[model samples]
Target: MTLRLAFMGTPDFAARSLAEIAAAGHEVVHVFTQPPRRRGRGQSEQKTPVHQLAEVLGIPVSTPASFRDPDVIAHFASLDLDLAAVVAYGQILPQAALYAPRMGCLNLHASLLPRWRGAAPIQRAIMAGDTMTGVQLQQMEAGLDTGPILLSETVRIKDSDTAASLHDRLMEAGALMWPRALAALERGSLEAVSQSSDGVTYARKISSDEARIDWSRSAEELSNHVRGLSPFPGAWFEMPGEKRPVRVKVLLAEPVSGEAAAGPGTVIEGLTVACGEGALRLVRLQREGKGAMDAATFLNGNSLPAGTVLD
Candidate 1:
């Protein structure tokens, strides 16, 4: 069945799904993404991943700031889309835009419905020590992610999984889920199941302030925090020096059995630090303005000696 589809998304995850959907032979007539924003070290304006991919695929693209304006809503309506698939589009669609398609909008959310249903689901789930997370395809509504689920598949959160790793796995899972969903839709057998209100939680956006490592927490907790923020806006701590404090990002850490009697944040031996409870051994870390390195290599070049306190 050749159905005219509109894709609304931004970011690499969404772009991956877009590629798979097109490859599956769906007619993605229009691609809507967020406006180009300045990014990177030079702060040059950059198009979103989805926008760039749409151009390569020769799909018409829209970057409207909002859809509440009647003209924007009318423009969307004129497309006469059979369905709209949205994944991390980063904008709240108005009721008019929600109803623009014949079958309404279906969203590819990173986490299972009713849990981690917001901007930073992937990061939040890891930080919360959740053992499992999944991708969900749901019918989008005016309410925030409070929609009926059409399809879902759970993925285990490995003990060694970081935010970057989990995100890649979920992206691949979501890419595969789209074709299965489309097949069901084509067969007219896809059912929308109302999401359970139980275990409802929101995964708020990760903030830089929150990325500062708090040594007062337990080692296990601190390890989870480090893993959750890995590879982006990394969890960090400051080490005292003769002249000034140097900020270092902790990319990977693990809780060790040994206990330290010293105060929290006290450096023990070989990248191990005392916390409020237990001890965490930093495995991989990065200095400000430097690339990441293993603990042994980082220690050989850096000057974090025993008894030094971290902030």
Candidate 2:
């Protein structure tokens, strides 16, 4: 069925889903995304992934910072949208905007409902060392991700899954499940169960302060932290050197057996760094303003003596 959908999203993950919906022959009447902002070294105006994708798809785009304006609400209502499909739209929908669409709004959330139900679900799930995580399509309510689940599918959290890898996987899975969800909705057979109040937790946005690696943490916990923030806002440690302290991002790491002889944060052997318990072998890392490299290459280029302790 060709449903009139107003695609409301901002990021690359949302763009992927929007593309899939269009490919499935949905009538994407209007695209709603955040306004372009200054980015990169140039600090020039940069369009969001969804904005770029919407332009390529030839869909009309709106970048209202908020839906509080009556004019904006009127414009939204004028679209006569059958449904509003939201994925990381980065704004709360007002009551007027939510009720404007005939079929109401549906959100593609990156985590299992009632668990990690906020902004940074993907990163939080990995950081928490969750054994399982999944995508959920929910009937959007006023509260943050506190909605009834229309459709959901679980994915196993692999030991080596970083935030970037897990994000891509979840995005693909959610896209695949979109058609099924729409079909159920169209058939009037979609069943939305209320999210359980138990095990409720918020996946707060990652902070720059929290990205600093704490060597006092256990090896397993430290490894989780490194992978959780991999590729963006990377978890890092300062390596004290002769000239200055070199800030290095730990992109990939694994917990290994080792004794903490020279206290925590000591470079035991290779890229293995002793923690409060066990040790973490850094597999991939990046120096400040440099490309990512393996432990050997990093060691060869940047001297990391065994007894050297990272500050």
Top-TM-score candidate index: 1
Provide TM-scores for the models.
0.97, 0.96
Score candidate 2 by TM-score against the native: 0.96
True-structure RMSD for candidate 2: 1.3
Across residues 6-125, which tens digit of lDDT does each residue of candidate 1 receive? 999999999999999999999999999999999989999999999999999999999988867789889889999999999989998998899889999999999997999889999999
lDDT of all the models against the reference? Answer: 0.93, 0.91
Candidate 1 has its poorest 10 consecutive residues by lDDT at: 255-264
Please write out the lDDT profile of model 2 over residues 159-183, one tens digit for every residue. Answer: 9899999999999999888888887
Model 1 residue 163 distance off true place after TM-score fit, in angstroms:
0.4
